[model samples]
Target chain A: MSSHQAVREGAKQVVRLLEKFPEEKFKYLVSFKATQLERFSRIAGIPLPKKLATEVPGENKTSINEIKDIVNRTSGPLGLQKDMLRKMQAAIPHDQFTESAMKDQITALSNLVNNKYKNYYDVGDKLYKPAGNPEYYQRIIDDIQGKKKENILAGLRTVFMGR
Target chain B: MLKCTARKSSLNTVTKLYGINAAKTYNYNPVSLYSTTNKNLQADQKKQTELEFDTHGSPIVRGQKSTIPEYKLPKWKEALGEYVIKTFGLDMDKIRAGPVAGSYYYSICKEQGLQYENEPLSDSAKFFYEDLKLPKTFSQWFQITALHEWMLFVRMRAMPFKYGRNYQQKLVDKTFSDIEMRLFDEMNIHSGRIVDQYSKDFNSQLKGAVFAYDVGFYTDDTTLATAVWRNLFGGRKNIDYTHLDAVVKYIRSQLYVMSRMSDREFALGKFKFVPTKEKINKLSAQEEEEMKQKIIKKYEELDKSGLLLPSDKSNLSYDN
Candidate 1:
């Protein structure tokens, strides 16, 4: 097959993977997965498809069987089967392997990708530092104080206009 | 695209820094280390080579001077403080996951592929960089550390949500903090802008690597190997199959050991990495049941004694 055709096929596979998650619930997650898929393609020696460089909406119509079959699927150039998935599932607690748990995992993964902190607001988004840092907290405080000053000035302007 | 080329060029400099003959400097045989039958010989070998670590548990590279100065705190005072903290439960608001994950857990992951300039590797680092023929570079070490961190992530996910998430955060925070320090202290990158750029680059790299490895773990070895090749091996041609197999086995073994640990045990930082030299065997059904029961009984007795303060109380499972 031509490299162009191969790239298309790879893109299709990636889209299929993204479709497993509900688009409305995981708007940001699908986008994260898209970029990750491109990286995976590069590493696996698969062609990169230019069309999938941005977000792709998913149908979120994945059936229970498809989720179950995820354990049995083979991927990459080697096409090696991971027969130990069933065993791994059994080793872990039942609550941890459930669909709901998997959803929690999806949310957590995206949060990590976005570099969101559990405690503080994401003020370091522009600075590219982690939100957990002391410097980040100072930024958050400064941002709030700046906004308060702006609100006071606006209030005074409104009062003057009324006069 | 630009970032990819930049990394490739950086790797070229690394290759120049650690010469091609660097691999031959450490002459340990990989196969001999893997021989399970030669248990006595292995013990003797371990005794023969006494590896010393600094206060931080990081392996001292070639009797090199420590980058940071040692603490001057008296041993008795430190021990007294620890005893008082444990006995009185002075820290009430948060669990001790910070010190456990940040210090203990981070050390376990970092030591796997750690290296320094002009210093010869001794133990596990030698196994990975020499026997496995992985490139000895700073970025390569980050990949190795990231892989192990992912394994811990799998287990940490099984923990109760609140505590588990905290542990993950602590580990993540420490990993980057350590990297930043290493860059400044060890690599001597004096410029703040360059350090910040490196930190940002690493943050993104880590995010991408974690997501890719998560998919691979939930999927198959091929995907996992692909992640490893891309991140650890830098997607070079002329790969070794056995090396990949060894890594997969190493990951599986670590995960299996962690799966059986009770939440309290894990939370208290009881988990240790299984040495690559040792083989891991699956537990029998009866053995697993007994192990679970034993953990339950121990925790139950502790609960019955009413010795734990509210701060020390944990709702996480002692058995599963």
Candidate 2:
């Protein structure tokens, strides 16, 4: 299947899993998925889906489903999807999620994902995020391409393990 | 301006026969009388008879020796006594016995270039006259008068006379003739009592005596009379007379002390001075920093307590 088609299918499966989880586990699922997508986006050199960007201000600007599909197609064999599903299932019983904690986690995860994408641009495009300046999409794409082989491997691992 | 006239006396014929001019009778010339033949002959006879006859007289001289007689030195005590008696018409004995005699004699000896013989009165007179350069009687009188006048002047100047009201303004406004008359009147009042008390026989001589007394009291040569005048009249003229008197007395006393001390070389004397070193301890950099920290801690505590006002915060801020 095409990369876009595979990304859409993976997004549908994630939505089904989220609906089945208790409300308290929703934050864990979102954070785990956001983290996994961030890894995928850095490796692929693509903007995050728009739905994910709406969920967090600094995430990739792509639809949520699109980001999920991209992660599933590119990162499924690496096992990030299975790992996040399992963590969500485990967190549901312990009251392991709280609104404030979830916000903190989301913010932290967003920053980490943004930094990873910024790093990709820094290496590949010779497009340094000058000490204080912001990173751009084209520079990120070029950066990811320059390190395409290693990032793809890492991306596969992040998808499978949800690191 | 008193004039005296005297009647001339006519000489008798016997007097004319003696070659005396009758018209000019009173102050007759004795030498002129001797020049007349009759008188000349009598004088010659008297001189020849008085002289001792010398058998081997070398070239007989007819008249007294041509050489002038050695000046007969007058005895100072006698001459001065006579002068005092005649000049002041006072008893010589009284003055000679008085405290001023030494100064009087000293003046005479100085004038004549004579040395004193340790006579107390003569020496004292000489000392006072030469050193102070004032006549004995005059110096004594001057000392008293000067003290009186200085006291009066100081008191008068000191008398807190306000600018518009005092005699000074009046002096400025009045015409010379009017001022003179006013001055005469003031002088009459001012000196009248003094004259009455000191000497009722106030003549030129008495005035001279009073002047001498005044001068004697104020004769400090260092600042001189001009400075005295300036001190007396300069600046605010309306100061309290009593205060001015006290100030003058203080200044005079200070001046006297200064004058006396100025003649001595204190530095070379036993009172030589030395300076001592002073020990100074200063704060080190560490101490300064510690002090700053302590102050900062105090301010922080104050701020935390909310005790500091807005003004305090504004002052505390670095940006301010």
Top candidate on TM-score is: 1
Q: What is candidate 1's lDDT per residue for B9-96, written digit by digit as tens?
A: 2123222112344335434455666689989867655543332222343232223343222425577876786677668866422357
Docking class of 1: incorrect
Alpha-carbon shift of residue B287 in model 1 (angstroms): 1.0
TM-score of chain A of 2: 0.20
Off by over 4 Å in 2: A1-163, B1-127, B138-140, B143-145, B148-320
TM of each candidate vs. truth: 0.51, 0.13
C-alpha DockQ of every model = 0.03, 0.00
User: Model 1 residue B226 lDDT?
Assistant: 52
Considering only chain B, report the TM-score of model 1: 0.72
Q: Model 2, range B1-320, lDDT digits (tens) per residue?
A: 11112222232212211113323543444465456558755555443223122212211111213211232345886567556555665532222212111222112212221222222233333433343233334224333223323322221222222211122222222212222332344234465455444332323332433332223123322112212222322212122222222223333432222222110111111111111122112345596467556646655677689764332231212110
Report residue A89 deviation for candidate 2 (angstroms).
Answer: 99
Worst 10 residues of 2 chain A by lDDT: A124-133
